[model samples]
Target: MKNRPFRERMGFALEGIRTGWRREASFRTQTMLAGCALLALLVLRPAPIWWGLVAVTCALVLALELLNSAMEAVIDLLHPGIHPSIKIAKDMLAGAVLTISAAALVVGVAMVVATGPAFLAEIGL
Candidate 1:
C-alpha cells in the first residue's frame, strides 16, 4: 500500500469521502458547515492566518468525522451485537467529533470577530 502510486492512493481516499458522504449524515452536515465557513472567509476577506486556521480546522473536523464513521462501520461488521466495550468505543468516537466541532466553532467566531469590522467598514456600514 505504501508503494502505491499517489494517484491511486488519492482515488482510495476519495472513495472513503464518497462513502462517508453517502452513509453518514453527520459527515454531510459537517461538509455543509465547512462550505459555509469557506464562504464566510471569502466574504469577510480575513487575514492569511485566519484563512489557514479555518481551512485546517475544517479539514480536521471533516477528516475526524470520516474516521469516526469508518470505525463505527467496522465495529458494527465485526461485533454485530451490543457490548459495553463496543458501546464505549463508539461513544468515544462521537466525543472526538464533538470536540473538534467545538474547536471549529471557535475558529469561526474568531474569524468573524477579527475581520467583521473591517468587512463592515469596507461595505460602508
Candidate 2:
C-alpha cells in the first residue's frame, strides 16, 4: 500500500484516539486522572522544575500505556490461539507500562512532598 500523506496520517491517528477513548476503559481512567493532575498543578502553580517533571512524567506514563495496549491488540490479532510466546510478549509489554507508571508515581509523590511546604505557604494555608 502507498504511504498516506501527512494529513491522512494525522486523520488516522485522530480516529484511533477517538476509538481508544471510547473503547478502552484504562485509557479513559488514565485520561481523567491526568486531567485532574493538570488541574491541581494549574491551581497550585508549582515550581517550574516540578511542573515540568510532572507534565513530562504524566505524558510518559500515558504514552507507555497506549503503546502497551496497541502491542496487546496486535499480538491478539496475529495470534488468536493460546500461545506461550504470545503470552510472554504481551506480559513483557505490560510490565514495561507498569514499571513506567510506578516510576512516574514515585517521582510525582516525591515532588509533591518536597514542595508541599512551599505550596502551602503560597496559598497561606
Best by TM-score: 1
Candidate 1 local lDDT, residue 44: 94
What are the candidates' C-alpha RMSDs?
1.0, 1.7
CA lDDT, every prediction?
Answer: 0.95, 0.81
Question: Across residues 1-125, which tens digit of lDDT does each residue of candidate 2 receive?
Answer: 46989899999888877877887787788788778778777876778987888788788877877777888888888889999899889889878878877887887788778878888998799
Which window of 10 residues has the lowest lDDT sum in candidate 2? 37-46
Encode model 1's per-residue lDDT on 8-58: one tens digit a residue: 999999999999999889999999999999899889999899989999999
Native-vs-model 2 lDDT? 0.81
Model 1: CA > 4 A from native? none
